[model samples]
Target: MKVAALDLGSNSFLCLIVEGDKSGIKKVLSDQVKVVRLGQGVDKTGSFHPDALKRAKECLTEFKKEIDRHNVDRILAMATSAARDAKNGSELFKIGEDIGIPIEIIPGSDEARITFAGSTEGNLKGDENVIVIDVGGGSTEFIVGNRSKLHFAKSLDVGCVRMTEKFITAQPLSESEKQAVENSVDIALDSILSEVQKYPATDVLAVAGTPSAIAAAEIGKFDAEKVHGFILDQGKLQKWCDILASTSVQEKIEKYKIESGRADVLFVGATILHRFLLKMNKPAMKVSIKGVRYGVALEVLRR
Candidate 1:
């Protein structure tokens, strides 16, 4: 079957089209993304802004055109974070329906499982105990497992956009603001600590944009082969977190070559990623370009 899987993320819309079967994927037809920022101001507003809805409409409509070109057998799309938080999420759903791409709002718990499924494929080794961290714009998913066995999975209400919206007011945040960002991540981690303790991970795999940007900055460019499977050291994560947090967003783009909209919340995202590594006491993490979209694509193949 030919499949198109959509990840309707808070900060971006990603689509993965693949040719695959019940056994596995064979060819990747196309992988595309657009920064729609669907969750813009959603953390405080609890509703979709008119511009956000317009962006969603434009994004999904364009995605449908792309999907049509593929002649796919199935199209699976899931809306996360912002959609779940917004009161008028249905407005975006209406756009999806009108555009011929229906949307399903998935809970964070499922996001964790799907994230794990995506990150682990071709990355795991012989029943290795692992943790998959998926940091998004509005939420972060912490998942622990051994091979295919999911030990613990939880989603925290801490993310780059959410943290930035809640506490940060300046480009170079004050010391207190940095601490506040850290505290938010820590508080969320603490809530799931007991459950996390039940399953200790041997390897850490981080997915999504935050880790991708960090890897690109460290590598001096956004090369997929260089970034994917890159082992990001613990100290380096902390180092980048502090450095990025001390600079303005434009500076991040100019210095790190970060994508424009992504630069704004990267520091907070770095903080979330680093703190989790520290909490787990892992020395380094492997970065994967595959995330929830990949997992959803796999699901379409099997279904």
Candidate 2:
């Protein structure tokens, strides 16, 4: 079967077309992503901005063209954090229906599970203790498991876009603002820290845009193959965070090749990753190109 999987995330909209069977995926037909900032201002306003909605609709419309081109046997679309938290999130569902694709808003726990399945597939050894972290636009999902069994999963409401809107106001964030964001992250991870201690992960795998973007920056390119399995250490993360903090959004985009929409919030994302590693006591994280879209594809194929 040919399947189309769509992830309508808070910061970006992604689609993947794959040829697969009940056993496993065979080949990726197409994969695309657009940064639309669907959760813009939702942290403070409790609703998606009108422009954000419009952009999301536009991106979905474009994605539909790709899906049609592939003649997919099934289309599975899911929305995360932003849509689940926004008071006016139903608007996304309406748009999805208009586009002939009904969107399902998944809970955080489910999101963590799917993320773990996707990020670790073909990468794990079935016995190594691993934790998969997805730093999304509106939330961060933590999944702790070994190769065959999931042990712990939790989703925290501290994400790049949410943190930026909530605490960062200056173009170059002031030290005090940075400190405030750090404090907020610490508070959010308090429960996660204790729970993670119980699991004691041997390896950390990071998925989603934040980690992917950081890997791309480190390698100085946007190639998914290169980014995947890329190991980012604390020192490299700190260096990149400092660079992102000192520069303007456009500068980051132009110089570091960060996605234009992600440039502004990249610093916050880096900070979250840095703090997450510190809390987890992991020296480095391996980046995964696969994320929710890949997970959805696997689910549809099996079904």
Candidate 3:
């Protein structure tokens, strides 16, 4: 089965095409993400900006073309924190309908569960207690449990794009500014920290844009073969944070060859991951390159 999954994210719009067979699945095609920053300022405004909406619609128009070219068996286009929380979400949906693509505004809880399912189902290896963490554009979702059952799940408003726009104003942020960002994460985490601590978990799995991009940067530095499901220690993650914090976004883009748009949010995302691991009292987390789109494909397969 060849399927297409479009993730309408706050930071980037991703379109994934995969070939699912009896043995396993393989990536067929991936659309280049246009950093529309759809959730830009949504944390404060409670609605999508007019410019962001135009950009999102333009990206979706491109994705719809690709879906048609591939003749995909199923097309699952889901929106996350930004579109889900926006006051004008219906307008966004109507825009999608106009483009002949129906959008699914998945709740944060469902996003967390689907992310966890993809992390576990795709990897086919991990401890019984796997803590799935997805550091997304607008929010972060945490889920801890085994394949059969999810023990705990929650979403936090600590996303890279959101945090960067909100707290990290200065380039290579000042010490005080950095502290402020950490404080914000701590405050937002307070409600879930207690509940997350109650769960008896071991292995930590991180799945989402931030973790994957961070792993890619680290791998580029080390010339690693593959970063999928790579076990990353807190020390290593801290090292990444230090490096990204020190380097200018241009330097990062030139050095790592990362997309210019991604360079800005990398540091903010790293800080969020570092703070999250510290709060969970976990030493390391395994990265999952696969995320919600893969889970959506799995759902299609099951059906």
Candidate 4:
């Protein structure tokens, strides 16, 4: 069967189409991503912004066209943190229905589980203890597991979009603003550190935009093949944070080639990952291009 998985995240909307059966995926038909910032003002306003909604609808329209061209046998669409938190988030489901796609708002725990499954797929070897970190736009998820079983999973309300809106207001963040962002990340991680410590992982695999963006910056280009399995150490993350903190958004876009929607929040996002890595006592993390969408596709095949 050919299956399509749509991930409506706080910062981006992604679609993955694959030809697969119960054994495994045979071929990847198409993969598309658009930074829609669907959680634009939801952190503060508690509702979806009109402009964000418009962008989401337009992006989904495009995704629908792509799905049609592929002639997918099944499509499973799920919305993450943004839709889960927004007061008017249900409207997103209505939009999906209108577009002939049904969108389900999944809880954070479920998000963590699927993220672990996807990020580790094709990567994990026998009995490897791995921790999968998904630093999203509205929330960050941590999952500790081996190749066969999941041990722990938690999603915290500390993400690029959320932290950026909450702490970073000025371009080239002031010392105090930077401190504030770091402090908040530390506090958020404080709640989960003990639990995470109980399940020590041999390797840390980071997924989603923040790690991908950082990997792209490190490689000087956005190539999935290179980005995947990339190693990002604490020193490198701190260096990128410093570079992003000093540069203007335009410079990040033109020089660093960061996505327009992600440039502003990139610093905070990297900081969150940095703090998480420090807390985990790991020097570096391996990047994974696969994420929730891949897991969703796998789930659809199972059903």
lDDT of 1 by residue, 16-58 (tens): 8998898877888998888888889998889988998998889
- Models ranked on lDDT: 4, 2, 1, 3
Clashes of each: 0, 0, 0, 0
Q: Could you tell me how far off, in angstroms, the CA of residue 205 lies in candidate 1 after the best superposition?
A: 0.6
Model 3 Cα lDDT, one tens digit per residue, 1-303: 887767777888877777786444566566445677898788888999999989888988988888888888877778888887889889889888999877887765576666776667655455467777878888888777876777888888888888888877766768887788878988877778887777777777787677777888877742224767677888988998888877788888888766677888888788877887888888888887667777666655555
lDDT of 1: 0.86
User: What are the root-mean-square deviations of the candidates from the true structure over C-alphas?
Assistant: 1.4, 1.2, 2.7, 1.1
Pairs of residues clashing in candidate 1: none
Cα lDDT of model 2 by residue, 1-303, tens digit: 999999888898999999999887899999999999999999889999999999998999999999999898899899989988899988889999999877887665577677787788788885878988888899888888976788898888898999898888876778898889888988888877888889777788888899899999888988988998999988888898889888888889898898888999989889888988887777998899898898888888887
Candidate 4 residue 209 Cα shift, in angstroms, is 1.0
**Which regions in candidate 1 have their CA more than 4 angstroms from the true location?**
107-109
Per-prediction TM-score: 0.96, 0.97, 0.89, 0.97
The positional error of residue 164 in candidate 1, measured at the CA in angstroms, is: 0.6
Judged by lDDT relative to the true structure, which candidate is superior, 2 or 4? 4
Query: Cα lDDT of all candidates, in order?
Result: 0.86, 0.87, 0.77, 0.89
Q: Which residue runs of candidate 2 sit more than 4 Å off their true CA positions?
A: none
True-structure lDDT of candidate 4: 0.89
Indicate the worst ten consecutive residues by lDDT in candidate 2: 105-114
